[model samples]
Target: MAKSKLSEKEQVTEYIQKLDPSLAETITFLRQAILAIDGEISEHIKWNSPSFYYSGDMKPFNPKEYKRDILVMNLHRGTTILLVFPTGAKITDTSGLLEGNYPDGRKIAKIKDLDEAKSRQKDLENAIRNWMGQIEK
Candidate 1:
C-alpha cells in the first residue's frame, strides 16, 4: 500500500536518502537537471519513485509505465540510458564517466564533471524536447 501524506517525488527522495547520504547530492543534481531541461516540467511521485513529467499531462509515467514513452529516459532505456538510483544499489562499471563509485549499478548518461555534465545537460534537454515534440503532434 502507498504511504499517506507523501507525494511520489517526496517518497522517491526519502528512499534515496535511506540508500545513502552521498546520493542526496546526486538526487538534488538530477532534480535540478530535470528542471533545467524544461522550465515547465512537473515533478511527482509514481510507484514510490520520483518522476519528472511534462506539465499539463495527466498521465504519470511511473517507472513501470516508462516504456510507453520512449523519451522518458530512465534505466529501461536500453543499454545507453538514464540510471535510476534506487536505495542501496551500486554502480560497478562507472569507468571514465565519473571519479567516484555510484552505490547503485544504475547507469545514467548524466555525468558529474562540469564540462561533461554540461554536455549531458544538452543531451537531456534535447531528448526531452524531442519527446515533447512527438507529444504535440
Candidate 2:
C-alpha cells in the first residue's frame, strides 16, 4: 500500500520497524499488549515515538489539556523506555508500575528491557484501564 494511504497503525508499524534493534522488540510487545486492552485505543507517532490515545468519544476539552492522549513513549534516554502519561495524576494507580511526581500532572512507567516489560505487562494494562475508566464521557 502507498504510504499516504496507510492507516495510522500501519504508520506506527513502520515507525517501530525503524527503532533501535534493542528497543524495537520490547516496544513491539508493548504496542500489541496495549492495543489488546480496548478496541478504542489507537496508536500513532507523536513526539517522535509511539503514542497511544483513546479514540472513543469523551466530553470536549481543550487540546492542550491532552485528555485524549493515553501515553507517549519517551525513548530519548536510550537505555530505558518511559511511558509518559500526560494526565496521569488523575488515576490512582496502586500497581507500582507507575511512578514519578511531576507538577504538570504526568506519571511515568519505566521498562528497562523485554523481560521487565513482559513481567510488568499486567500492571501496565491495569494502569491503562485505570486511566480509561476515569475518562469523562
Candidate 3:
C-alpha cells in the first residue's frame, strides 16, 4: 500500500495512530501533559516530523532527530538538551526500555511501549520543571 503524503500535523497524528492502538490513549495523555506544563505550547512540522514548541521561542522540541530512528523530545531553554528514548533514553539511566541510537554514535533510551512512554513523560516533565526552576534560581 502506498503511504499517503501527509502534512506535518497529519504525519504526526498518523505516526501516533500506527503505534499500538492502546498507545493512542497514551499519546493524548502525553499531549495533555505537555500542554498542562506550558499553556504556550504549540505544534508545528520540523524536519518533516511533528514538533512541539513554546510561543515566542525560537526552537521546537523534537525527539526524532538523531539518526531519525527513535522519537525524541528536544527542550531548549538555558541549556538545550535532547530527551532521547530507552536504548538512547538519557533520563532513566537504566535499561529494559526501547533502545535508541544516534547517527553520531550517541545512545538514547528507546520507548518500548506505552508504559515506558508514560514513564518517560514524567521524566521529561520533571526535566522541564527543573530547567525552569534553574532559570528562576
lDDT of each: 0.47, 0.93, 0.47
lDDT of 2 at 43: 94
Q: Could you tell me the lDDT of residue 115 within candidate 3?
A: 69
Clashing pairs in 2: none
Q: Give lDDT tens digits, candidate 3, residues 1-137.
A: 99777775576677667655665565556656665776655554554434555443333335443322223444322222233432233333333333345554444333444566677876656644433332211
* lDDT (10s digit) by residue, model 1, range 1-137: 88589765666667657644444455556567777766657676554445666565544445553422222224232223343423112223223332224643232454433345445665555545555554432
Measured against the true structure, the TM-scores of the candidates, in listed sequence, are: 0.49, 0.94, 0.45
On lDDT, the candidate that comes out on top is 2
Candidate 2 wrong stretches, greater than 4 Å: 1-5
Q: How many steric overlaps does candidate 1 have?
A: 10
Q: What is the Å distance of residue 103 in model 3 from its true position?
A: 11
Pairs clashing within candidate 1: 8-45, 9-45, 83-108, 89-103, 89-104, 90-103, 90-104, 90-105, 91-104, 91-105
Better of 2 and 3 by TM-score: 2
Against the true structure, candidate 2 reaches a TM-score of 0.94
